[model samples]
Target: MTASYVAIVLLGAFAGGFVNGLAGFGTGLVALGIWLHVIDPLYGAPLVAICSVAGQLQTLPAIWHAVNIRRLLPMLVGGVLGIPVGILLLGHMAPDLFRLSLGLFLIAFAIFMMFNRSLPAMRWGSKKTEGMVGFCGGILGGLAGLSGPLPTIWVTLKRWEKDERRSVFQMFNLTILACVAISHLAIDGITVAFSQLVLIALPGTFVGAFAGIRLYRRLNDHRYNLLVLIMLAISGITLVVSEIG
Candidate 1:
């Protein structure tokens, strides 16, 4: 890769890791777009998968105590089950249309969350519900390397506490991303460029993750909710532009 490309990858990694650390998700949403400028999505998607796992691992120490194993199990199972289906559909599906539709939906949903004060919490946010959401997340993850949105939106609507949200976000993302990375690697043996990019991105991931954890620690419930909504809006716009551009 050229020097400029290396710089772009590193910059994207830091920014993506920062967002992931802060919100427990969204590294690909922020970073893949940047990396796509330097590399093709075929390679970029796997790079995102590996780098995102690294970023999530960085924040694990801080959020480990908050993880709810019971709540996470169903999602993990559902996500795993959905992956093959998503992969099967990837080449045949019209991703641009799917992404545009998803982006608009996220944008509209985030707006509602931002303005509405009386929105009711999902009292029935049970394991079944989480599993359905996770299945959708896995499908998206397999199809486009974007899995964080559905779970993030679900937890946000459920009005989960900061810790609970982080726990779910971090663990859930780590699982799906790892699965995607492995699947990609199994199909396409790791290239020299991919290995180099992963190495180049590691430092940024660690640094940004450290900073993000600190910021996350200081946020109250209200601030956390606001942050998630803002991120959802930004991610939605990013997806739309990526599809259309």
Candidate 2:
């Protein structure tokens, strides 16, 4: 590969890894925007999936104590069950329009949340509601490799502390991304070239993730909440721009 290609790949990997580390989700959202310029979406998609899981795995242990399996189970179950359905819907849906609509919604929601200082934390959603959110997230993850936004938003609404929020969404995203990676592997076995690209990406991913985790540790709950909202807004903007372009 040319030096420029290598540079671009590493840039994307680091950016993705950093975002994943800080926010607990959003590797694909950040990386794919940069990687798509150098690689086809077919390759770019799986690469992001693999790299995202790696970044999450790298940081998982730090947040392990916050993971509550009973609280997390319903979301995981619903997410897993929704994936096949999302994959099925992918064939029928107009993906661009769907993404556009979702993008607008994310932007609007993020802005509203950012401004509404007096909004009360939502307490009405029990496990069933959480499962439904997870189900939507799975479908999005399956359809668009976007599983984090819905659950992230839900957790934010619940006003869980930063670590609890991070742990839940990070674990949820890790599971969803792992499933995506395996599905891609099943359909398209890893090529030698793919392995090579992964090797190039790992160091950047590790470095960026560590840096992000350090920043994450420093943030208070309120700051982390704002950070997530800002990231979601940026993600929305990215989606809208990509679709329109």
Candidate 3:
């Protein structure tokens, strides 16, 4: 790779890692934008998958105890089931419209949270209902390579503790991204280029993640919630602008 390419990839990884470590999501949003400038998305996408997984692994130990398996299982199952459909829709759908709508929804939710001190508790008749939410997330993941927004919104509305909410964000994203990565590899075999790109990006990913976790530890519950809401707002605005531009 050229020096410029190396620079872009590492910068993207560092930014993505920091965002993921601090918020437990948005790695793709940060990194893909940079990587796309130098690499075909076909390869850059897989690189994102690998880097995101690495970022999550770095933070797993800190939040392991906070994960709620009972709640997460349904979403995982649903997401897995929905992946095929999302893949099918990838080339068929108007991705910009879909992303724009999702972005608006997220911004609206953040606004609602700002006004309402307590969000109404979300209830489902069965785990399957929650899993259905995961299914939708997975479909979006397959369609646009974005699977976290829906789940993040759902978890946020549930009024979970900061760490608990983060556990879901990290694990849920890791699983979905892993699934997408495998699908991509199965269709297009891995090459030395992919390996090299991942290796080069690892250092930036680790360094940023380390710094992010430190920042995360310093935030109280109120600050944590505010940060999450702000991140969501920023992500929503980013999505809209990216599509429009």
Candidate 4:
């Protein structure tokens, strides 16, 4: 790759990683915007998906010790069930609709936090709730690759410890990434161009993941809240504008 192209990819990956560390989200969206500048915007979904899954793989080991296997199963079950349909809709649906929906929901998440004094830690719920969250969350995860929101909200509602929430969310996303990557590879076959992009992104993603993991350790609630709001506004505006166009 040319130096200029390499620079773009590295910048995107680093930004994505840092954002994930600081805010717990935005890596995909931020990476999407950054790469779109160099690559075709239509390629954003698959491209981000690849880097995202890679970044998660890197982070999962750090948080692997506390993964609460029993609690995680239902979400995975739900996510798996929804993946087929979600993938099918990826190319067919309007990107703006998807993005705006994400924006509004993110804003709502910030609202949920502002009204409450505690983070969601509602780990005590019925099997039915788990199943419901899993099924719906899976679909979102498979489709837009942002299934962490509902589960994150669920954790927040239960008032989980910050570490527990981050650990679990990290695991949840990585799991979704694995499943989605398989589908992409098995069904679509990673094309030559996409494969090249993936290679280009690897070094950048590595640096990003390293930096992000460091930040993830130091982040707290207030800063987390601000980051979430900013992401929501930015993502929302993008979607809203995309829709208008």
Candidate 5:
């Protein structure tokens, strides 16, 4: 690879890793924007999945205490059921339209949440509702590497404490990303070139994740919420611009 290619890959990996560490999700949102400029989407998608899994695993120990199997199971079940369906729809869906619609929704929701300071916590969604959201998230993840946003948005509305919320989406994203990676492997099998890219990305991902985890330790609940909102808004903006540009 050329120097510019190497630099872009490292930059994308580090950015994605840092976001995953700090926010418990969003590695793809942050990384793919950079990587797609140099890498084909097919290769870039799997690379994001691999690096995101790495980043999440690296940061998992920090949030292990907050993981509640009872709370997480519903989402996982729903998400698992939704993945194959998404994979099936992957080729049929119109890419530009899907990205545009999701992007606009994200941007609008983030802006509304940011402005609405006293929004009441949504207390009505039971486990069933959570499961449905997870299913949708799974489909999105499978289809477009976008599994994080829905769950992230849901937990925010649920108004759990920072660690609790982080634990939910972090674990969810980890599971979805791992599934996506496996699906890619089953279908595409990793090229030798892909393996090399993973090797190149590993160091930056680890270092960035570690740094982000350290900073995460310092943020209070309010700041963490704000940070997540900001990340979501950025993700939306990235999607919109990429689709339109």
Candidate 6:
């Protein structure tokens, strides 16, 4: 790619990564719009996914204690079941439907979480429910290469403490990214085009992650969620606009 394209992708990665690090889900939403201006949308999915996988790896260490097996285990269990179906369905999905579906989900979920802000406060699920959440997450992950929102919504529904809620979210998404990275690689095959962009995205992701972590320390998560919700709405609107145009 040309140096100008590389610069744009990296700038998106920087902002996407930081927002994700601090807020937990908007990295792809933020980056996708920016990157779409530079690259074909097909390549855009995997390209953004790769950058996110890299940044989440960096965050795994920083939030070491935040790892809760209760949350992770259930989601992972559900994810394994959900991924294959999602992959199969994705192969048949029209690009427009996929884009619109994801956009709508983000918009609705963001709005609900912003106003609702309520969840169960206990480990209140059977193995069946946990697996169901993971199944939903995995399907979304396989489809879009990003689907941590379902599981995050699940935890939010449970009313966990704010720190626990955020921790579970980061770790769960990190896991979803890991799963999506593998699926994307297997399904799409690695391309030099993505590799070249990923090289540039790496540094930008780092820059964003550092900024996000700094902000994480300062803001309580209610504020954090509100900020991210607004971003999600903006990102979703842009995607729809892009499609319409």
Best by TM-score: 2
The TM-score values for the models, in the order shown, are: 0.94, 0.97, 0.92, 0.84, 0.95, 0.83
lDDT of 1 by residue, 33-91 (tens): 78888877777778878888998988898878888788799998888887887888988
Q: Write the per-residue lDDT of candidate 2 for residues 1-245, one digit (tens) a residue.
A: 88888888899999999998998888888887788788666788889888899999999988999999999999999999889999999999999999999999899999999999579898798899889999999999999889989998998888889999999899989999899999999999988878878898878888989999999999999999999999899889988988998
lDDT of 4 by residue, 1-245 (tens): 68898789878988887666555556776787778778866566667767777787777776677678897887777777877777678788876677777767766665656677555445468867776786777778777776767776676566555667666666676677678777667777778878888888877887888888887667675565455556655665655666676
Candidate 2 displacement at residue 181 in angstroms: 0.3
Question: In candidate 2, which residue pairs clash?
Answer: none
Clashes of 5: 0
Q: How many backbone clashes does candidate 3 have?
A: 0
* Candidate 1 off by > 4 Å: none
- Which sequence of candidate numbers ranks them by TM-score, best first? 2, 5, 1, 3, 4, 6
Looking at candidate 4, what is the lDDT of residue 244?
70
lDDT of model 2, residue 184: 94
Q: On a 0 to 1 TM-score scale, where does candidate 2 land against the true structure?
A: 0.97
All models: lDDT?
A: 0.85, 0.90, 0.85, 0.71, 0.90, 0.73
Count of clashing residue pairs in every prediction:
0, 0, 0, 15, 0, 10
User: Which pairs of residues collide in candidate 6?
Assistant: 18-208, 78-134, 78-135, 119-157, 119-158, 119-159, 120-157, 120-158, 120-159, 121-158
Candidate 3 global lDDT = 0.85
lDDT of 6 at 85: 78
- Looking at model 3, which ten-residue stretch has the lowest summed lDDT? 117-126
Predicted candidate 3 versus true structure: per-residue lDDT over 135-221, tens digit per residue? 998998888788888888877777778898889877888999999888878888878888788888999899888888889988877
